[model samples]
Target: MASYQMLVKDVIKRADILLEVIDARFPDETRNNEVERDVARSKKPLIIVLNKCDLVSKEKLEETKSRLSKIAPTVFVSGKNRFGTTMLRHKILETAGIKGREILVGSLGYPNTGKSSVINGVAGKHKTGTSPISGYTKVLQLVNAGSRIMFIDTPGVIPFGENDEYIQGLLSVKDATSLKDPIGVAMKIIEKLCAENKTALESFYHITIGGQDSYDALILIGKQCNFLKKKGEVDDTRAAVRIINDWQKGLLVI
Candidate 1:
């Protein structure tokens, strides 16, 4: 079990080509600047796989690609639907070209970016363990994508001292089970989602958010979900955790 830093270094060293997975909704936020520097130092062909593209609008996806292209070769992917696996595979083959028939493809991303699912799609199976929680994969686990490609799943590389409660919660890098202020972080998610599209959030959750602040809306959601404690008190923690999990799972959408 290598530490995250050492594990990331191993990923950079082993993989001939790297896929840096970022959430389609918050590509900029999910991206790790340190990982970018490490990839640059490794001099590997780095591809940016915007995971969960299905949740984002076509316009936003295009905008993201336009900006992200400046950072690396970008590809849109919906790991759940396996929507862009063919394109991903092709780009990888093209990038890793000619030197050898067999190529190792590894991924780097902050937590909950669906890196494992994306690579599983690349391999055409549910070969990797994927969860909404952070830090699932502990080390590089090699799986054969085919005769030509060895796919590697690396432990998610998150930065230290992520002071922003909202960022930490949304990215799911912080241990939600141990979070002292789940409702606070959940409010951040609510604020962001509401600011983006209150209608979408309302429609998805089947809860009217009209004139309600994020805190109040979350309590309402807890009620809607029938998550209550003794004396019929709405369980704020349950609702908040559910929201964060849904966001991570892409069920909440972009």
Candidate 2:
């Protein structure tokens, strides 16, 4: 927790404007208390960037957008492909309405949600090192986005402490698998998806495991997906990773 304070607290408090980036595919996951606390404390204008729209289904994207509308101005942008990024910039400008304001905009999101990539894309060159590994950006990085747009980039937030409702929801939607054992996290995801998104699951797998317990469904998914060890025992970690990747990529939309 103390280590996290350096990254989350220090960086979040310093920003004058906050651009909370969330994976567009999973709105529930983006509802982070750390960011929420930051926003509340700072009381600065915030623009929500639903990054990685290209990977999520249209229906899911729409659902995420609707949910986010209540929070702040939201934009869907693909940092990798540069899709919908211009609109994001435009929205940021409009939301800030800060004429000659030295706005400190923080690119915030969970790990692997493409914050560094988006910053580099917006900067029109390689700025921060983007990688598949989680928590790569350890210290807060500031990128030049021309005049009036100084961007503060921070490390991805993965909840570490006990069950906080917001953290639970964030872990669920954001695919925060790296925070804990992947298998346990995957089981949680499968159960939540089974209850909340029947159509999406069916669209992906053509089967329903709504009647089963969360752990049972996880085992079934692991078996079906062939996430097994040498002894033919369920490899919870492997199974969890598979399901989480599928869910994040919209491959499990059945």
Candidate 3:
């Protein structure tokens, strides 16, 4: 995958259009400076594709789509499942008004945001390498999508340098997953769930956590949620593991 900086310059030099692929579940994390700068500088008509809509709630998804609608037409798609991918292509064609013109569509997003998966779906094959791991695509590769459309796949956006707003939006938009400080992330998730989904929390923890202190709740959650050590002590890793697992599986989608 090619770096956004390089792609920005190259798009200014060559491409006529830009399609930013953002994961709908984590739109704030995926839409960063690279996209903004590229679109702003190139003055190209931009199409924002909200990928991974399957992972997020419909209310949240519509809200995000409305938000992006202020700037560019937004299409919600699930790149992995091929949801809305065809509609997205049609939107691209309609926006560009060049059904037969050679068009360059820049596929971009942060790590694990499914840029390659979108390309593969658009191309009708697994031509681009996609994996569960983040940052799998290291170079910008161009894929042919029939006569008039070409998809340019770029590397995951680096949170560093010239794109902090996009990075911040992505990190804040999604549920707090990449907090790195797992304990803090877990605590936040637990507290949020305690206030929002008490029954699910109780089922997962087997204890009423609605009004418990955060620390006590954490321990109780650890015990019931399998975050316990062999000695039956509260283990931070196990606690964090459970919380992350729950968040990834949409059980903690508050």
Per residue, candidate 2 scores C-alpha lDDT tens digits across 148-172 of 6667766665543464432443334
Writing each residue's lDDT as its tens digit, candidate 1 over 1-254 gives 43677778777887898899998888877888888898899888899999988888787889989999998889999988999998998899887774656798878887678888898888885243423222234535677777487777765565445466666677666656667688888898898788776777888789998788999999988999999999999999999988887876667765
Pairs that clash in candidate 2: 200-253, 200-254, 201-254, 202-254, 203-254, 204-253, 204-254
Show the lowest summed lDDT stretch of 10 residues, model 1: 126-135
Candidate 3 Cα errors over 4 Å, as ranges: 1-4, 125-138, 160-180, 188-220, 230-232, 246-254
**RMSD list, candidates in order:** 5.3, 5.7, 6.0
Candidate 2 Cα errors over 4 Å, as ranges: 1-14, 100-102, 125-139, 157-159, 162-182, 206-210, 222-241, 245-250
Model 2: per-residue Cα lDDT at residue 65: 82
Model 1 Cα displacement at 67 (Å)? 1.8
Q: Please say which candidate is ahead in TM-score: 1 or 2.
A: 1
lDDT of 3 by residue, 38-116 (tens): 6777677788888777766687778889999987899888877888878877887888776556787776566666777
Report the lDDT of model 3 for residue 74.
93
Q: lDDT values of the candidates?
A: 0.80, 0.66, 0.66
lDDT minimum window of 10 residues, candidate 3: 128-137
Give the TM-scores of the predictions, in the order they appear: 0.77, 0.69, 0.73
The best candidate by TM-score is 1
